[model samples]
Target: MDPTFLSAVQLAALVRGGKIGALELLDHFIGRAERLDSRINAIVVRDFDRARQRARALDNQADKSAPLFGVPATVKESFDVAGLPTTRGHAALKDATVRVSTLPVRRLEAAGAVIFGKTNVPVDLADWQSYNPVYGVTSNPWSTAHTPGGSSGGSAAALAAGLTGFEMGTDIGGSIRVPAHFCGVFGHKPSWGLLPNYGDPATSSAAGTDIACLGPMSRSAADLQAGLEILAGPDPDETALTLNLPAPRATALKGLRAAVWADQAGIAADPETTAAMLALADALEREGAIVSRSARPALDPLDAYHLYLKLLDAAWSGRLTEETLASRRRDLARLKDSDQSADAVMLRMTDVPHRLWLGLNEQRFRLRRAWTAFFREWDVLLCPAFATAALPHRQDGNTWERRITVGGREIAYNDLLFWPGLTGGYHLPATVAPIAATQAGLPLGVQIAGPIHGDRTTIGAAALIEQALGGFKPPPGW
Candidate 1:
């Protein structure tokens, strides 16, 4: 087996046993990166010399039993890495915004993990595909013509290609989960504020500060846990809240009540995706987990998706100029009598008043309360991560309306946001687990959503699911 393809857990064990030096592991991954990264475009900027020096130092250290000690990891370029430029995939800001190495980066460094390089992201970390002028585009390891998903696209691609043990990325919308879904890896978006998002240049905006979350994306659930342990904590600068809670323990998998809401009556999931989720449910059932197929409390996936868009848009509202806001207000004024669609609601959010936003915030709280009550009867949720498998790469972000065929029916392109938006509504924790692959050889992932602040619960269940159904499968041509 290739050492670069070793899981973080395996690498930690190897380091502790002294069977292979941490420096050797770094060298192995670095060499693999040099060989494969050019085709995948996963790594945007690399610092192999610094990583080798640090790995050498870690090899000499006495305390090598840490969970991620000396493991090589990549960070999404949206996060600061000191010497590397934090472009956030925008070419213009390369000189203005310097990468100062945030708390998340520092924590990972403290854990004795070697930083090999930074991954690519969409421009300003806004799109679903990772492509920008700064570092070009990131291609999926499974298929070069498809996107790996963004803004964590590069992180997922790197992990899938065995370029690194694991990686860290920020998620506000579906940034973390979508990439994991597209790239066929494990990614966890912890409960709101579970991890710090401080010090990234992309997060410098006043409004951007409140909505974004930093989390882990890896090839295995264990790697996600390891990365989360290193990144979760209060901001050292006292400007952010602290969440230093211990990891939740799962004594066993038996008798754990889980909800199965693969597709609400309204949304149509692709046959391949629906089948993949059903297969996972069957596997979980055999694992001694009690599964319930119940109506999910009248959950409105489109509504939830729309609400998520509104909330996320508000987070970046400050970036809009007064003239732009006025123009949007004018646009909305002309549509006061028109019916609302998800797209219309998303467009209207730009001109929403403060009072209206306050009311929406209250409604969001009610939604959260409803989800809290719903979780009382369920411990985990198994659903689709996206509407389809990995999509072919398109630079203009205009491919979302191409009407892909599914289950003998055609669906709109942008409809991909609905399933993912379900978890975003209540600010719940979600884990993306790769279940199987499609007939076309593309990977399919299942999304596991849990109650707010119950990140470990979702992640723990995902870990068990991985054990029940064999974990990640390496992509060919890596």
Candidate 2:
């Protein structure tokens, strides 16, 4: 087997057993990536020589204290890696100076992980599919005709293609998990604020923002947990910072309570997707999990999602040119007759009064409380990762207006948000479990969510379910 195709855990075991040197493992992946990355366009920048040097250094020390010791991984282009161009997929940044590494990246490096290359992302990290003029588009390993979800698409695609063993990706809205789903890989969107978002090269000129988070995308759930353990916590110099997350109980799944809402009123899942989720539910029930088919973890997720969108818009609003703002003002004025004017939408959020923002936070608080209560009875919740399987690359400028077929029905492009928004809006922890392949051979995943701080249960349950239903299958061509 190719060393590059080994799971992070498996690779770690090899390193411990002296079956392969870390530098030798690095060479295996580097050689493969050099040859194959051109086809997928998953890697944006190459740091092969430097990565080899670091791998050799780690081999000299061979310390086992670091959880990720000697493991090779990639960072999304959006994250800074001091001295590497942090071109969040923008051509204008090609010649820009590299910024310092983010805390997440720093933690990974501190843990003895070799920082390889940066993966491609959509321009400005706004799109769900990774593509930009700088690095071209990243294709799904399963089918080049389809896309690996983005802006972490490159990371997901690279992992799926065996170009890299693991990667660090950012998730504000399905950026991490969606790509993982599309690529038939593993991803974890941690509880909001669990991982630091600092170290963005784009924010080098400005202070860091917190709406987004940095997480791990890998081939197995355990790797996500390992990365999270390395990256989760407050920054240094904080007078009082303590993070003590609990490990999952060793209890069997037979009696575990699970609330399932595979279908939602907001969006329709594809026939194959629906079937897959149902199959997973059945599997869990047979495994001793007390599946609750009646209860659905409900929130006005649409409204919460809208709020998240508004805040996200505000975060990026500063980058809007003056001319765009002027046009938006006119658009807002004309939208007076309608409730949702594009201009008013952007302007209203930018100028959201303290009271209004407070009210929004209160609503978010209430929703979190409701979920907290729901989790009290249910050990886990199962949902869809996206409305459809990986679709053909879309060039349309409006992701919201895009449409996809699900269950032989047409669904608005934004309908994908309904499922992702459910967990993201509350900053809860969720894992994507690959259960089956679509008729077209695309992978379909079910997003398993657990209460905030219940990251262990979410991942633990996924591991059990993955074992029950056969786990990852090697891509046909790979």
Candidate 3:
């Protein structure tokens, strides 16, 4: 096997068994980045000098039994790595230095992984395409003409192209899952608050943000599981509390209950994306897994989406600039009472009053109860991670003003937020795993979602699907 395509666990084992030196493994990836990164532009913030120092120290150490022993990895650019600028691709924050490493980074380091560099992200970490003023753009290894997916776009790209042994990324919307789907990797969008994020650009304080989660993204499902164990835990201050996430319910496809919602009525999900999902369902059924295409949560999809837009916006409302808030107010003023478009609802959520926010919270809890009931009968719900695969480089304007074609009809680009928001809004854990590719050869993945705190179940299902489907094929010429 190529050393570049080996899983983080495999790399660590090689180092511990003296088959490969820690520093040598780190340098192999560093050399690949130096020679090939211009094409994908994934690792935007280089810290190779410091990474080599750590790798050399690991090689010199006598005890090499750590979980991630000597594995080389990178995190999303928004994570705080002390002395590295935690810029989310904004030019203004180009010089703002991160004084402390984030909880995820510290934990990864504690597991004996060498943190090399930070990946690229969009400005404010808002868009799906990973392009911003600071890092330019990251192209998919599958197709440089298209995106790798964002705001964790570069994380997925680096993992897919074999530039890094592992990666950690955040997912509020589809940041982690979308990139995994586009790049044909495994990404786990953990249950909210399962992983503490201390140094994210938006949540620099001791407190973490709502609706957002810090999790792992990698080319292998086992790597995703290992990375999650390294990344998921308490904040430094929350050491008094014990962490006990649930274990996997099923490791094999037999006797597992899976509900799939690949395409919905009135929603313009691309047929190719849905077809990949259906194929996975068929494979699961063939393996004795109970697969259903009709099981759905009791809550309405549109209502969940509208509520999701508000709550999603509320999570980031505090970071909104006066200019941006003013733009939202202007957008709100032009909206009609019956206008429930994703853009309209999100714009209306700017500075939501406390009383109204409380009402929304009540509604969200009720919807969450309904989802819990639904998940009680199903082990996982597989769905389309995105309406389409890696989109063509679309950096023209902000997200709402953009449009995407689905099934020959044009729709609001943000409208595709249904799948991600529907589950993530209520804080369900979802793991994305590659199943097959489109006729055009673009990779396609299915989102395996389970109930809140069911991270293990989702990730386990992903591992089984990975085994059944021959996971994570490297893109041609990578």
Query: Stretches of candidate 2 above 4 Å error?
Result: 200-202, 205-211, 301-307, 315-319, 336-350
Which is better, 1 or 2, measured by lDDT? 1
Model 1: per-residue lDDT, tens digit, 1-478?
A: 5676678888878888888888998888888888888998989888899898999899889888677887898999977777667878667767664556777888888877889999999887877788998899899999999999987999999999999987998887678988998888999988777677667545453223444678899888888877777777766665556565535535466777788876666565778888887777787778787888663744465666677768766876766789967877776777655635444566678767899989888878888887888887788888888878887876754433355554566565555667767776568889998888999999998888888888888888889888877878889877
lDDT: the better of candidates 1 and 3: 3
The collision pairs in model 2 are 128-150, 254-288, 402-413
> What does candidate 2's lDDT look like per residue over 1-478, in tens digits?
5676777877877776778888998888888888887788898788888999988887788456577778888989988888788878778888786667877888998977888999989888877889988888889889999889898999999898888877989887788889988999888888887876666545553344435667888888778878878888886734368798878743576887877777766456777777888887788888888887768555665566666656656656666788877866665565554544222344556445668767776777788888898888788888888877897898787564476676777766655666776787777898887888988899988898898988888888777767777666668887
Give RMSD (Å) of candidate 1 vs. truth.
2.6
Which of 2 and 3 is the better model by TM-score?
Answer: 3
Can you list the residue pairs that collide in candidate 1? 400-413
TM-score of 1: 0.92
Estimate the overall C-alpha local distance difference test score of candidate 3.
0.89
Candidate 3 all-Cα RMSD:
1.4
TM-score, one value per model: 0.92, 0.93, 0.98
lDDT of each: 0.79, 0.79, 0.89
Candidate 1: C-alpha lDDT: 0.79
Q: Of the candidates numbered 1 and 3, which has the greater TM-score value?
A: 3
